[model samples]
Target: MKIAITSVGQDLESKIDARFGRAKWFIVIDTETNQHQVISNEHNLNISQGAGIQTAENISRHNVEAVITGNCGPKAFTTLNSAGIKVYSAVDGTVAEVLEKFKNGKLKQAGGANVEGHWA
Candidate 1:
């Protein structure tokens, strides 16, 4: 499965970003093939306001199966859901660590949506 882990930098060694849609880069990791690519998030701040559509489209383009992040706002939650991508919250630690948790089925699914203006 293709899992996207939000990271602070361009590599998996970077610490995990607290927000999903606003992360600096979405580290796309392919579990089966062990392939990984980092997708730059050009609008970490603005995406929260009006780029949900674009973020959803970008994620769809990657054929991502699920997203692992520390937080996801309500708008993004709905947007990602509509795009047929599952989102799991509370994924802390580095990008690689989070990916391992997800692969081992240990990452917790977000119990609720985050409030707007919570990330900043």
Candidate 2:
């Protein structure tokens, strides 16, 4: 499975980004080969609205199987779901920690969007 995590920085250790479309970068991890790649999101962060739409489109384009992020809006959730991609929100803590939970199936699917728009 291919999973993508929104990150403030390119490294896997970077904090999970709150903003989906305007995030600095997305760390794409291939679960099978364990290969990690970084992709830049060049949308204008200042005036960007409906970030969820763009985010969903981006994830769909990448053929991502899952998106483990801090938050996802309504549009993003619907778009991802229609595209057959599961969106896992409210995933706080380090990237490595979350990944471990995911691998072990310890992290169950979450509901309810957070107020801070991330993993608060």
Each model's TM-score? 0.85, 0.84
Best by TM-score: 1
Each prediction's total of clashing residue pairs, residues at least 3 apart in sequence or on different chains, is: 0, 0
lDDT: worst 10-residue window of model 2: 111-120
15-110 in candidate 2: lDDT tens per residue?
Answer: 888766567688888887878888777663554466676777877888788888877776667677888887778777666677777888876664
Q: What's model 1's lDDT at 114? A: 58
lDDT of each: 0.77, 0.74
Residue pairs whose backbone atoms clash in candidate 1: none
* Residue 20 alpha-carbon offset, candidate 2, angstroms: 2.5
Put down candidate 1 lDDT per residue, 1-120, tens digits, no spaces. Answer: 898887889988899988666677888999998799989887644743555446666777899988887877777787788778888976679887887777788877764565563433
